[model samples]
Target chain A: MEIFMKHFIRAVLVLVFLILQSTFCQFIKIWDIMPNLVLAYIISLALTSDDIMYAGGFGFAAGLLWDITWGRVFGVRTLLFMYIAILAYRAGEYVYRKNISVCVIFTLVGAVITESIFFAANFILTHNASFWQSFFRTIVPSAAYTAAFQLVIYNLCLKISKMGKERSSSV
Target chain B: MNFFKSKLFIVLAIVTVIIVAFMILSAAFGFGTGPVSNGLNIITTPVQNGIYGIGKGISSFFEGIGKSGQYKGLYDESQKRVTELEAEVREIDTLKNENDRLRALLDFEEREKDKKLVAAQVAASSPDNWYAEIQLNKGTNSGIRKDNVVYTDNGLVGYVTEVGPTWCKVLTVLDINASVGCVVPRSGDTAVAEGDAELAQNSECSMNYISKDATVIVGDSVETSGLGSIYPAGILIGKISSITPELQGLYNKATIKTSVDFKSLREVVVIVG
Candidate 1:
């Protein structure tokens, strides 16, 4: 029951972020760039998670939900985020996962990677995209904006992860 | 330890292939509006609309407070002006203003009486910056359909891209994928108004393919030419902000400031038929 509760809490967190990203975040654009809160949450969750399957699964579910609700192309975010989770998980093995700075840095890297691939795929498929225009105007700035939230989301995920672990140990 | 041999690595590889295949199929067949997406939207649209309403309310509350002082100052100035003006002259001026405004509204209504328009509130905007689209609270249930034209009182917004049971997505005129057949009413020169990546960020688009020798100039009002079946004629799109020669001086391109203020867009009407 405790384990189920822990997973349930994480699922709820994903939904909240997804809703916030689609709705409230629209009103909070800074310099015409809204932070990708779901991406930030996925990266943070992946970093703090010990199991690769759990990290990948969470990422998959979050991306799938976002794609279904608001994405132009389905499966792109799902694949991108799932790969990002695994990459972050592998990177976490080498670094101290509890470090806030590490989380922030990883988020920055992860955001850039995700945005770059998305842009590339969009450009290839559409053939109407401008590389320099999108890169300077949107991609870099949006990555930084998404990374800014790493501090808060990472800590929240860490706290939740620790809480679940504590309950299991106490039991 | 060979990481490639790990069970988790193998599983991830298989998942990646499946997802990529799904993406290819979705892109090719326009599968983003399939059953899964519709089902999810049905479940999530209410939550999104509710949150959007709350956000709008909170924003409006702060905006109202900020504007109250400005309104107060305007009111005092208007009162002083009213005291200075002759009573008969003031009454005549107010009547003239009201008459002109009513006449304009009546003209627009008379012109659009044949079109079936469904009023909708914006439920949410696209989550990513890659697209400039918004979801409306009304969809197929409300007689809204894909490709239905959406607009505000000011001017053309865009058309519906996808529709679900209770919600629809509108790709605004500011989106890069959008294009409209436009004419400069003053010069009578027709042009194509297309969304630009750089200008869309500023809520602007570009009107292209104007004849180089056309007498079009700055501040010329551009409206739909009705050349295309999608957008009806004479719907005001925007005004020419700047004009520059394009295609080695063969044609001219003018930057247009869209009449509809996308940032403050809340309520819109969709031409269902």
Candidate 2:
């Protein structure tokens, strides 16, 4: 029951961030580009949490919800985020996951790769845009913007990760 | 002792196959309004809209405070202008009566009398900037359908792309995938207004495929040609801000400064069929 509660709280947080990503985040756009809040949450959770399956499951659910609510194509973000969670989980093992700088770097790299893949697919299929233009102009700037927010998100997830541990140790 | 044969790798591969299949099915079958989307909409739409309202309220409170002093000065200036506008109103009223009589003689109908409009507030924006789309609070229940034209008091906004039970998504005029048939009213030359990635960054779109010999110029008004069935004719698209020769020199392309301020677009009207 405790484990179920932990996962349930994580799911709720995912939905909250997903909502902010679409609604409140718009008001804070820097030059028409908003930070990827949902991606930052997924990265932070994957880094701080020890359970890979939970990170992957939450990431999948967030991506599926985002696609259904806001994305033009379904399953695109779902696939990308699932792989991103796994990669972040594996990378977190080699480094000190609790370090804020490491968490920020992970978010930066993850956001860049995600945006690049999404833009490339859009360019290849549509042929209506210039790859280099969107890459330098929007994708890079958006990744940096998302990375800047990882500082706050990482701390938040770190607390959640410790919540379960602290209670278990107390018991 | 091989990574390729690991359970993790096998699981990842299976997930990949399943997601790719889902992507293909969604794209081919147009499952935008399928059961999954509908279910999610039912759960999330009200919550999203409520959060948006709260956010807007907080922001407006701060904005109102900041504009209080500015509004005071504007109010004083408006009082002075009101006297001048009162005289102009009397003259305009006389002219309007004369114009009405002339229109009756010519048997002309009002331009906007036929279209029905439904008002909707913007509930949210696209999660990523790759596409310029917004969610409206109204949906199929509000008589919105795919390709229904959206506009503001200022000008044309975009068309509805996907509709749920209580919400719908609109692809704005600045989206790369959006295109509209437009015409330069002064020259009567038809052109296609299309969204460009580079130009959309500046909140602008491109008017392409203008005839080489056409007398199109900057500052000319552009409106829908009514050539497309989606948008009605004479709906204002924007004004041509600049015209430049195409790279191949075969035609000309004009940049349009849309009249609608998409950045602060809080409300819009959907043309209900």
For all predicted structures, in order, the TM-scores are 0.89, 0.88
Docking verdict class for candidate 2: medium
Clashing pairs in 2: none
Candidate 2 residues B22-125, lDDT tens each? 88887787656778877776677778788778877887888868854554554577877865765686689889989976775344225545767789998887
Report the poorest 10 consecutive residues by lDDT, candidate 1 chain B.
B67-76
DockQ of 1: 0.72
Per-candidate chain B TM: 0.84, 0.79
- lDDT by residue (B1-273, candidate 1, tens digit) is 798998987998998888888888888887658898788778778999999999999988988688545545545768766555545565887899899868866876787899898999988898888778899899899999889999876899999999999999998888877889999888799999988767877889989889988999899999999988798898899888998877676788889999888887888989987
Give the per-residue lDDT of model 1 (tens digit) for A1-171: 766777899999988998889898888888889899999999899988889899999989998888887776678888888889888988999989889888888888898889889889876457567777788888888888888888788889888888667866887
TM-score (0 to 1) for chain A, all models?
A: 0.93, 0.94
